[model samples]
Target: MEQAVPSSSLEQSPLQQVQARIAQAARIAGRKAEDVTLVAVSKTKPAEAILALIAQGQRVFGENRVQEAQAKWPDIRTAHPEVALHLVGQLQSNKAEDAIALFDCIHSVDRPSLVTALGKAQDRLGRKVPCFVQVNIGAEDQKGGCAVADLPALLEQARSAGIEVIGLMCVPPADIESAPFFALLDKLADDSGLPCLSMGMSGDFEVAVQLGATHIRVGSALFGER
Candidate 1:
């Protein structure tokens, strides 16, 4: 396991590098770098590291597992009360209720039943939370996402069920350039009237931004490998 850096060192260490990447991406996109939200994927990473990033003004974060997040959320929330947490990993139906209680956004929702589950969970929680339609743009059998053709109907169903489908999320094939997949998601979000496109990661965020990614999920690139 990786130990967390002390607050002082973490505050000074990697923030400049993160800011530079965001600046470069924004320049390429012709948008202010400040407009792009960077979500540090913090799964398996210690809470102290999260505090270091929060000290540098990074607010949004992504977690891959509900259990891991549950373990970290309250402690981390005590450290940074305003941080936005996104569920960027596969969500099991059994865990939907708990996820609804934690995440500010669910980024890997592909099934209709999951959407229904979220709606019911939100009703119980008495809040409307934003969601993303995960698209398996790579069409990988091992991946979790809706078929590209089914997104329209899924969005419609989501809207009617009181779950807001705000955009799309995808993990492209490792060997393929991410721009095409990002473009496909951009087209879908635009055509569907969803303004946010949550795509890309530490590896190919530059390509994602050029292709109109509104939010980026970066892990190793920002916090180093877990």
Candidate 2:
């Protein structure tokens, strides 16, 4: 008879499982997992929940709102200053300064007005925050990203406004095939000479990985259901 092994040791934490999936996806794409950055989407998760992942070695996180992030991250940052936070939602023109103060990166820059606000904030604060220009790949009116037709003008405006535009971010239409959308975003980023692509989420991140996603925002896959 074969010896029995410990069942406890066979189970993997959610974070580990996600990381393993990321690695597998990267390998399938002939890419290094180290080249991919997983932004643990901690938006709406409580402080305790975030700390659970922190204990599990997740150092980068994504939050959707400035006020909510302010309420949660100050103490968390004090405890773990190495944690890098990204603002991964629609940023309001009024919240630019606050967003600048809280997030290490802003991934929702879509309009010229927002670019202007962020630029002014960066100037007044005497610090610069790198930003990802969110592109509405599917051109959905309800979404927050800029329209495909406006991308060039917006990028130019952001550059002239002095915002550190680092790359592009997008959210594909829900319940439809996301690969084509991801592929388009990848092409758009490449055409614009941007080096980073912040696409993918809990469900379609693997596809995003295969298409050159530098950052993947994973929420439930890493933290379990809300």
TM-score of each: 0.92, 0.95
Error of 1 at 192 (Å): 0.8
Candidate 2's TM-score reads 0.95
How well does candidate 1 match the true structure in TM-score terms? 0.92
Regions of candidate 2 where Cα sits further than 4 Å from its true position: 1-10
- What lDDT does candidate 2 reach at residue 136? 93
lDDT score at residue 150, model 2, on the 0-100 scale: 92
The most accurate candidate by lDDT is 2
lDDT of 1 by residue, 104-175 (tens): 988998998998888888898887779999998888899899999898889888898899888888888897
Model 1 Cα RMSD, Å?
5.2
Q: Per-residue lDDT tens digits of candidate 2, residues 51-98?
A: 999998999999999999999999999999999999999999999999
Which model scores highest in TM-score? 2
- Please list the residue runs of candidate 1 whose C-alpha ends up more than 4 Å from where it truly belongs after superposition: 1-12
Clashing pairs in 1: none
Clashing pairs in 2: none
